[model samples]
Target chain A: MAADLAHLSPLLIVCCVGLGILLLDVFADPKQPKTFIGYVAVVGLLVALAATGWLFATGGVLLTQPYFAVALTLDPFALFGFALILVVAILTTLASVHYLPSQRCEWGEYYSLVVFASLGMMVMVAAADLITMFVGLEIMSVAIYVLAGFKRQSPFAIEAAMKYFFLGAFATGFLLYGLAFVYGATGSTNLNVVAEHFAKNDPGLYGIVIVIMMIVAFGFKIAAVPFHMWTPDVYEGSPSPIAGLMAGGVKTAAFLALARVFLTAFGGADFENLAISWREVFYWLAILTMTVGNILAVVQQNVKRMLAYSSISHAGYILIGIVASRSVDGGAVAGSGLFFYLLAYALSSVGAFAVVSMLGKDGEEDITYGNLAGFAYRHGFAALCMVIFMASLAGIPPTAGFLGKYLVFTDALAATHMNLLPLVLVAVVNSMIGVYYYLKVIVFMYMREPRREFETIRSVPMGIAFGLAALVVVVCGSFPDTTIRWSAKAATGNPSADSAISAASVIDVPAPVATTAK
Target chain B: MEQVIFWILAIGTVASSVAVIVPPMGRNPVHGALSLVVAFFFLAGLYVMLVAHLVAVLQVLIYAGAIVVLFLFVIMLLNIQSEDLGHPRPTISKLIGVIAVGFVSIVLIGFILKDKGMAEPPVGLPSDSTFGTVKTVGNLLYTSYIVPFELTSILLLVAVIGAVIMAKRRL
Candidate 1:
């Protein structure tokens, strides 16, 4: 139907772009330049972004029909994810243009793989069925595995890939096993169907066990404490642009999916009243992940490793937002906080990695804290951009990260009224710890003395991309209203204000069992 | 009879899986590969008990028959001997491994404890008329899961291409 086609247009465009890139790689002369492929991929991503905006403006949910029979809900939530993914994809593609060439490893397949990975990420955040989510997760992960080991001759790259693959597959096993347990309890893989089952049936012990398994599975994807070992090594070994993609794009998608599953599906009065509580699990995880990640980052000499740990810590902060959203009193405010934080974090982190990508020569840079000394003297603009990024990451004032942290703190404070004060205090202490390393980068760039001669690579396209990201960082920080309001509206779940409150309460209590067999 | 068979295979599976991980003094790669095959076979037997007959067959066919053979071929091609096993990695690596395994075990035990009261008799009786036989499974695969089934073929094709690309001497 025309309606279905219109609703699905963004996803269809991304998939088609992936295929087109593949075909282009195959048919194009072998000797043709690699930048051509990169250009085509960028164009595709930009078009996808434009199409997504058009859908947001005019499509009106594609004739207002749900796709995949309620198994996969194509709604404003999915549209939000689609928009974020396209932005991340375009930024990553722009960063990659300079990055791959600098490494002397410019392969056309790299662009195709990036596009495919973006498509996979879209599917993941949009998925409404467990199987669809699993498939999407694997598709994203497999491409990333290859990209991590793109520098095949480097032993570090190979080791990173091996670790990522082994751990990723292991985590996937946990996810599948968890799904099996949920299926056993609910007799269905659809999120709504499972939620309905939990609402009616006692579920009793099975409910607690399945919820724990699901938490562990999602915990691993988001790199929470105890499941975060793969992150540092992979980020360190990967090309800087790909590292940006993983930290910014991949983590955001996983968190979005996690929110959908936990908040929308397994949440509500029935499950909340049961002996087990997911809030407690997230509460403990958020505290530990933030503390451990920031503590470890402080001891790291390598900039890449430090950033990797910083990302893990940020995951913890984001998890706090997710936990707050599930609280009794906190609703759309918490959800919107998470969305804003995701956008802010993605912009700053990708921009930081973009600068790192520029610093490398022939794909090799032993970028220790000492190596970055006096970088500001040579490349003032790039150094200033990096400073802004680090400042934002540290949640300093007059930057998007500061506003993001403020929103999260506000949500946490709201939750504290519902007896979640411990979580809020833990987040506060973690943010304090995060300030140490984020400032460490600044100290190295400005205060420390350079050990060797500094040279800057000037790539016009990459500079433009980084500049745009930096601009958004400042602009969003200055005028946070428009984006904040949009995110709040999306989180409301109902168009009318009074209806929004009722819908929130209705979702707070799990829906009664209604069999789909009819 | 089924319980007896399950106990036997389960014991074998656990023992071989342990052997695969623990390198006996001077244990050969070929021996490790063989142990892996035995473990796979026992897993197939367990699948049979679970009434996933087609999966059981495929487990034996693909894992024991094909994958282990590939492992053996790789070992032979690389000319890796029992004595070629390098020194154990650093103490930190060993500690990390032990901690990871311990964490997994703790989580598993936690889940088992949580679900102890809700354990139920496994569904899908192991009879040709009731549960999926090979023919029935094939029919369902082609009908209901046809899209994924076809996608799996494409995955296999990609894997083949990837293997060739990886092994090739030059592009």
Candidate 2:
């Protein structure tokens, strides 16, 4: 019980903070700046980050606790994912402090919703059961739906909210049904139980059904190809900061959950079991998602819309790591690389959107490429940051994004069982295509003649967000060893843990093996 | 006798569901919503036949009572004109969508009905047949399923805030 409480403290603190903010917003002086709430939310997230760090330092105490019934695991992988999500939340809260007031929509619920959304993501990364994961996903999705339309007066914002809400609900249905089928096949909702069941039995027809439905559901969440129809419209219509949150924080959580499900539950050394070899499905998805995302991104006129496609392409890149993880030797390497890539992507994306948000003033948003004309001359620092972000996104050297791509591609190449060379080659080609659009933005900012003298709302909090994101990007790029080691440790633990499961349950499966075991 | 009650409830449920969606009933939104309420009530009866007493009660209380009333309120509030509702357009895309969904449903129903080697009942059901009773369900919900149960409260809270923010007269 003590261990459970200790492990659950982070989620508890975050939820309490969220509710506290609601109360504070209800009672605080109306004349006080709403940014105060944002600051409080930041403090709360930082504390949660500290809690995660403390749990990490304590090592196996929290990790070994029997809190699995709560559908959470305080494992290294979850902690790493939680830390990345917290970073996104902290940066988003900082950016929102500057943004919401400018748009006159800085309500208390905004910060609370952001915190609640982070909590949801935390729940997702920590989930060890399907039902828990679904609840977490819904929590994150609901908060984001409201956040997307925070600018209540904008027709576009409302439309984005409605569209995202309806589509997200549909996807949730897919996920829930998939989970139901999985539970039916294994007679358990626990991921460990499913893994154990599959170890002893053939996956049968229900396995394929579960995998397909889950793919559709997660594909929508991460905005993979053919499931990415809502990305551009939703991102374009949402407030820039919230768009950053959706792209950065939400994607990180969803992918981590995806990785957890596929790599832990279905990711076995079973290439011959073609029905459940999700690697093949992911390989094809990787190629299609990258190609479609880059192709669509290149033709977009709006910067936000361009980034939405860019996010989809990033999902494809992460899918490479997943496919590579299918190899027995490469599981840890590829899995860790996936986490590193997400962190790198989150930093660059949040910073880029921070710049986009800065470009708006008096409720007027600059969303188009032309709107960025000669931005270098007008706001040299922000433009310089944009250059760094673009370079990182384009996989330029000495940037985190480049290292991220390098690690994942090499990891894919290192996988012996899976012939991912063709896929990696396609990914490289897609990245080349991706460079064109990211560069287009930089060119507009730097080379093009100055259009209307850009007027932007400059606030201290947003500057802090951009600076922190840029600093992390550059530093992580320069010294990649620490993050690489950490993510690798997180990923490597799964295989050993799975082996432990079978060994431990050998004596415990005497009677049930004949009945429930099937 | 039990089969007779099951067939009556099942038929009523199907009829109301069809009435809820089929065009003329939908032309007046109120009629469609009221038909939905009838569908929900019949579904509750089906649940009762399955001995899911708690679920039957919830179906009545939550779906038939709260949800249907909310739907009626929205319909009345919108006060949408008959013309504003517009005539049903039979486009190729709509037809394709319907056909696709129909085919998928057929496939799913086939899968559900097919015997996949299961000839016995699930093992864990209480022999006393008190499994779906309110007490047993409440115990399970508050014990083993506690995490999702708590999270559901948070979901409702967030939904309330979102609804207020979206629907309130002033920001």
How much is B100 displaced in model 1, in angstroms?
7.5
What is candidate 1's lDDT per residue for B17-103, written digit by digit as tens?
A: 988877453467787888898899889888877777889989988898899999999999999765677765669878998898799
Candidate 1 lDDT over residue span A23-140, tens digit each: 8878888775677777788888888888778766542252222223232345556677788878777778888886776776666667767877787788777665676677677767
Model 1 CA deviation exceeding 4 Å by range: A58-67, A273-276, A327-334, A447-450, A494-518, B23-26, B87-130, B133-171
**TM-scores for every predicted model:** 0.87, 0.94
Q: List iRMS for all predictions.
A: 8.9, 5.2
lDDT of 2 at A113: 91
Model 2 CA deviation exceeding 4 Å by range = A60-70, A269-276, A327-334, A494-518, B1-8, B118-127
Task: Calculate model 1's interface RMSD in Å.
Answer: 8.9
Q: State what share of the real interface contacts each candidate retains.
A: 0.02, 0.37
The TM-score obtained by model 2 is 0.94
Residue A269, candidate 1: C-alpha displacement in angstroms: 2.9
TM-score of chain A of 2: 0.94
Q: Tell me the deviation in Å of residue A391 in model 2.
A: 1.3
Judge candidate 2 at residue B69 and give its lDDT.
97
